[model samples]
Target: MNEQLEFVVRAAAIGTGATAVMDLWGLFLKRTLAIPPLDYAWVGRWIGHFPRGRFAHANIAQAPRIRGETPVGWVAHYTIGIVFAALLMAVWGLDWARDPTLLPALVVGMSTVVAPFFIMQPAFGAGIAASKTHNPSTARLRGLITHLSFGVGLYAAALFSAHLFPI
Candidate 1:
């Protein structure tokens, strides 16, 4: 494969793996502590309203439901993951993927919280960093932990890719 194509493939794989890891972490939390995972359907609803010129909501839960929201949300979730992975590679270079390291992955992963804190959360009507939620601190903590897990996933996925591809 050509260099750019190989990079794209690798980024997609790494991002998917990282997103899966994040989901697994959510599942673990839910199973062990009864903590519910994020309902991506809300994300879909938010995105679904895009064409209607609706961006921000006071309470996304109160927003009207969109058709195929669940699928759209899930796809957006994974696509975001892939974009983040591609960003990591872009900043650190493909060499980082070949010789994977924890710090860079973690940095990129954790930093992704910026999106939800500023963009997604606000647009979802949760306020910045989920401040409008019932419990902002807990919400923030959960988000941090989730993002941290994604960071770990990035490292793990990169390591796995290196082992599997060896190129």
Candidate 2:
């Protein structure tokens, strides 16, 4: 494969793997601790409002439901994961994907917390880093844990990707 194609394949594989790992972690939390996973439908609803010139919501739950929001949110979620994987490649280069290191993956994974904390949370009316949530500290911690899992996932996935899509 051409270098560009190889890059794209690796990015998509790594990102998808990382995101799946994150989701599995979320599932573990829910099953073991009774912690609930994030409702991606909200993400879909939030994005659905964009076409209507709506950006931020006082409470996304109260926002009008969008058709197919569940699927939309899921697609967006995975796509975001893919984008982040691409970011990992962009920052560390394709060589990282080939070598599959931990630090860089962890760094990028953990850093992804900024998206929900600053952008997604605020837009969802959850406030910065979930500051406005019912329990801000708990929310923050959960987010941190989730992102850390993603980081770990990035590393694991990169390793798998290296094997699956060898350079």
Q: Tell how far residue 14 is off in model 1, in angstroms.
A: 0.2
Error of 2 at 123 (Å): 0.6
Using lDDT as the measure, which candidate wins? 1
Full-model lDDT, candidate 2: 0.94
TM-score of each model, in listed order: 0.98, 0.98
Instruction: Report lDDT per candidate.
Output: 0.95, 0.94
TM-score of 1: 0.98
User: Per-residue lDDT of 1-167 in model 2, one digit per residue for the tens?
Assistant: 99899889988999999999999999999999999999999999999999999999999999999999999999999999999999999999999999988999989999999999999999999999898999999999999999999999999999998888765
In the predicted model 2, the residue pairs found to clash are none
RMSD of each: 0.6, 0.6
